[model samples]
Target: MTCQRRIVSCLLVGISLGLLFTPALGREVSDIKPANPNLCPKGREILKYFQSIYGKRMLSGYNVYVHTPDDYEQTGMLAAIWGRDVQWLPPVDEVIAHVKAHGYLLTLHWHWFFGGDSAWKSKRKTPVNVARVVTPGTPEHATAMKEMAAAADILEKLQEAGIVVLWRPLHEIDGGWFWWTDLDRPENTAELWRMMFRFFTEERKLNNLIWVYSAGVGDLKKKPVELRKRFYPGAEYVDISGIDLYGVNPAEDEEPYWTFFRAMAEVSPGKMLALGECDELPNPQKLAAGRLPIWLYGLPWWGTPSARRPVEQAIATMRHPFVVTLDELPAFGDEDPPPVVGILSPMDDGSAWFPEGSVTVEGYAVDRRGKVVRLEFWANDQLVGQLANPPRQFRWQWTDAPSGCYDLRAVAIDDAGQRFRSNRIHVNVGVVDAARGRPVTASGGENPSAAVDGNYYTSWRAPTEAEEAWIMIDLGQVHSIHQVNLIWGWKIHAEHFAIETAKEAPSQAASWHRVYEGKNLPWEVWKATHRARFAPTEARYVRIHFFRRAARQTWGGYDLAAVEIPIPPSKGAE
Candidate 1:
């Protein structure tokens, strides 16, 4: 059978099965309208609803690039269908009808090219030029017109069905990979994008479509910020701006991802933003903890669910309260206002110290207009605990929280749907005696024991102004240490120091490996604490080798009021 025949056969089979199980339509597409005159209402409502729950809730979406709409039917997830999929899978009209009947939002993206090949392989026989294709009165223009008219057929069907779509086309246009933005000639991609936008909106009169303009992380020559500015199709042509991200490990580095988000927001303020396509779904807990700006929607690439683990993570992320699934969405125009909340305990700028082991964190929340619905606590971008309504004072216990420093905050939601986040607090959990309070003798200090006597008033004074003086501490046992806090004596600080560790006693011939080094350390003045953090390492003997003093006078030399070390639970303990 021919390719078209095979596609038709597969679509018919899906439709037959759909008809047997499909239910009556729950909502009419015409009821949804964009708040902005230039955009579609359904698309606007989806964006508004998601923004309302951002940092308190997230919305889950999946792409059906190679699969039929029936794939989502079994999973009950919001549907993201690609324009190319219509040609080889279920027909476009059928997919729209199925989503509408099931009360699901539909997002459409087109990997469109000038020629008919969906894969976008450049033709060697006939070189493709975007400049010529966008210019009128050219053969390339005529070919592009014919191909786009065919795509218009699909949009016209959707319009006739009164189906509003989050339509993204010519996506990742800033990149050199796609034929539309070919590296050989990238000068005309912006013009080509504008031409297509006008063709679809003005000539075709496709009002039911919500125009989405998207780019990738970077271009061939420029970064995301500059590339987005260079290829922007203008605000009048786009309702939403987005980025296509893949292979993002949020646990490792989230700075670049956040940078792109902020850059897009700066370039197009008030416009909705989305994660257009990503291979890995971000942790919903982190998304709700204010790690990144509020995104309207997130749609992982179509084939991500082929792996079981990714699918599981996707499901869990979708299940988060911050994420809105098709079933959890509010009706059009019925979204409730979010409430305001604050954290009353543990001053935002202050650090809370807790002993190693089980501990309870406390905070207070309030909502002026509506009753507070829930209070959620986050630790290091992950949701650790939550409390239900009626309780203004919130407390959660961490039974096995390891010793370390954590970024802590609380998010409270009210009955009106408003979300309020408290200022972040730095919490330090430390194990006592990690340093064993043993006397750490320094070559230049006269009272070495004062450095570890757990007293802030007394001081350990160095005898002479020596750049190579060393201070050594015996941990008493081989322990895993992650952080060391040094308290500088009043008005005195070290100009340079190196933290070294060894399994054996420190001696002139001892093999002391350097763990950390610092230069020009500042005196806190108020708190007098300087913290050195590093990856956990096992050592019995630790030392601080001072190279210089901030004070030039030899009378004071170097003075340390106190030193503290924190140890986390070992892997064997867990």
Candidate 2:
């Protein structure tokens, strides 16, 4: 697609995913004489500024502005602009001139019909009930239309100046606390919007307005897309789509937003999505520019990084397409490079887990990109192990593991300070013994135990005949085994026993996968053995079970002496 098309697509996505809105109404603004489309010189300049930013791809570049004691000044830094008051209109010429000087557009903060500037100052939050706009000529409806016209008038000038206004009118209307709620009746909600559009466009003649709709996370529960469609002003009036979210840590709330976007995309895939505003910090690790490109409005709302410091970290982590700021909007396309000195193994480069196995690190080296590095292992102050560059997974011998918990640290150094140390990994190794022979039961009965050395350091047990019996074993490390021993008890009734291996914790018959079967043994023999040889596969659990008849001699039991798995050599195992 052309860049312009791509930008438009992105903007549309931003609109639907980022903001949601609903409204209410009163006076017949449609009947009142509409404002003439006369361009204000300052307004024209402002409109151009907004168009320069909102009309292009975020990948291109845009300027942001902030208010100052003197007239508005051009700020290189892109900052989040807030709208707290909307009682009386500002000096139109002054406000327009200030916005023009700083290259900033007016961002209207909309509230409910019953909620005037006073209510906003008191609550400092948008009122929730926004669907009441179509309440049939109510006083609240009249107040809403009047506010819409006034706000539209400001936007009209901004639009005339070629600066697009981020018109956030009647936001958070999905929440029940606001008088404009449309949760129960979405159609009426849509009607209220028709009234709003008529008042703003037909009466106020505000063509440069980029209608921003907003809703909270709760409103999504009722169906964000349905809510949007029921009240959205179609493609002509809406310039951007966004959502209002807060207090949700990106670390924790990231998934829900992803889900919400996936659903929203399905409903309105063509709108640009953005985080209209936030009263809390979002997780940077979880948010990538491609998945959810958002403009964080509030800075360091809360949390660990000192209020101001988190913003720096947030800025560091946020890449292009994702902008973070509180005071000034920075120029785009000047992102710094990724960290050079870092852990290479643990391969922070990309995800490593496969469908089949889990990773248990021996150790790894951290270093700069494209450099030969050496790793040193440390436990408290003691040196333990080391590895050179190009090495990823490290394996520790079962015997070398310490008895108690010890921190496993890996630090990398190409030359000097270019080193990274992994957070310590606690390792506690325990030992287990291997048993000899096929664990065979001496007699076929309810239960039987097979023995090796009377010392019982390593032994095997058999299953019962009443139903079916099984024995399980765990192989500590990832090893390949060629042979397995199984001993049958006197109740040698089944035609064969099935052997299986698995990687999960063994529970009542839950962890084993069938691998081998053994022929039935004659009853005369006190014990019988079974063996199997196969290519090596890493498994922690080994299980054996009678595959045929449950019991041979009695109704209530069966037996086995033991099940043993011989470990494979490490060198050629993988």
Candidate 3:
């Protein structure tokens, strides 16, 4: 049978068996809901606690900008501090213990100036090639490991104190301003990310951490798809998807804020999303009225005498009915029982045909009071694989399985010695076909189609002599665009460009409006990718206008190796 026919047959069989496996797709903001409690009980509990008060109250969080340990008592808000602040504060253990004693929900953010003590030496001068610091077997890697080990020691102290921490490290990496920005080695950033995950989870054996993957809005504006694709450490490594914004004008930027939030949720489904760091708090009225995605939490940067808001305003926002403060938080130890665990994937009774000799079994487990200790995958009542101290998402590979039907289920065991089993799924070993999405259409370029052809080596280039040119794409139908990525060609480059959109085909007299403009973009052949973000704008057409090419010794033209536009999933979408 043809691939289409086989897919149809599979679907029919799936339907008859009362098991339908829809491919993972984007999600709409309205579809946002609490993740399965069995996936990350502690994380889920925290999220559920916030969700219970979502439309009624907002949580108050404060960063340790200076050495003000008393700030927690003064404001009665959740406590957030920087890892680097350990340089000037009391011992890490002492600080965390004191905060816990005060009953504050604690979180940590790391600026992580890899090569040096600070992110900058002066105003704009940052250490270069910091990406190499995370690459293995290098002198920089050695230094990085030593420094990280010291930091791990501090975190170990927290683990010993039984303090569950919302740990966000190497944040805002997509922006070029930070030292740890992967600009120098963008291709290797994923490796660097995995290295950190392994270090923190395996080497340090830190169990009190809830890892948060965070990026900056500035970077999201430049390369939305690539920024997330390149830097995302994967769902298994991240507990929360976070974004940092400073000096935000909420009235003007609300759409962009929601766009980013929706995009984060789409890319990392089942992971709680948070406003990891922000300078200005969003409107409390909007937050209480459910005008925004139910964020897990909001944390503001440290307030100094030089740039601080009235303590009254902070206090009021925290006291908002939707906000949850430390004092209002529910007790978790004995009052909260061990969470019930359930698998989220390989749907109960669902089946997959894989004649490729291998299949990946994946799912998640959560507990409200205790941490998940292990996840075991069983096939035909025999253990196939297991993960220890796994993240919410767990995966195990079954290789060289004999061609036949088999029963599979996953068992989760938590730290409290409570065990939960997933519903059994059936698998059939057979040939499987790959799935692809609809192709994109572009207006102008030597090979306009190449940009969306999924081949990174091939590119679409405007005529060599064309000083001004434009490329437009049809997304099939109108979509709420949150982010756009422009991957530059290896040799040819553009120094300036403008991104515009419209409900109809773009033209000077049409309804097209510029959403983002690029100026003096850094020139690095094949190394530079620009991402642009705007408030969610509904558009069927997107256009990029290139005005000037960068000065180069070789060919002169505007060229892009690839382009990607990621939209949020519609309501009821998979």
TM-score of each candidate structure, all chains considered together:
0.48, 0.39, 0.48
The numbered model that scores best in lDDT is 1
> Compared with the true structure, what per-residue lDDT tens digits does model 2 show for residues 468-572?
555555454445554565433333444556767777766656766666776655453223345455566656666656655432554424444444454422222
What is the C-alpha lDDT profile of model 1 across 74-115, one tens digit per residue? 122333222333334367757765654444556776666446
lDDT of each: 0.60, 0.43, 0.58
Candidate number of the best TM-score: 1
**Which runs in model 2 stand beyond 4 Å of their true positions?**
1-76, 80-94, 112-140, 157-162, 219-237, 251-253, 280-311, 314-574
Write down the lDDT that model 3 would get. Answer: 0.58
Between candidates 1 and 2, which one is better according to lDDT? 1
Can you tell me which runs of candidate 1 are displaced by over 4 Å?
A: 1-56, 67-89, 118-125, 182-187, 219-224, 302-309, 333-574
TM value for model 1:
0.48
Error of 3 at 516 (Å): 63
Give the runs in model 3 whose Cα sits over 4 Å from its true position: 1-57, 67-89, 121-131, 219-221, 250-253, 304-308, 334-574
Model 2 deviation from the true structure expressed as Cα RMSD, one decimal place:
22.2
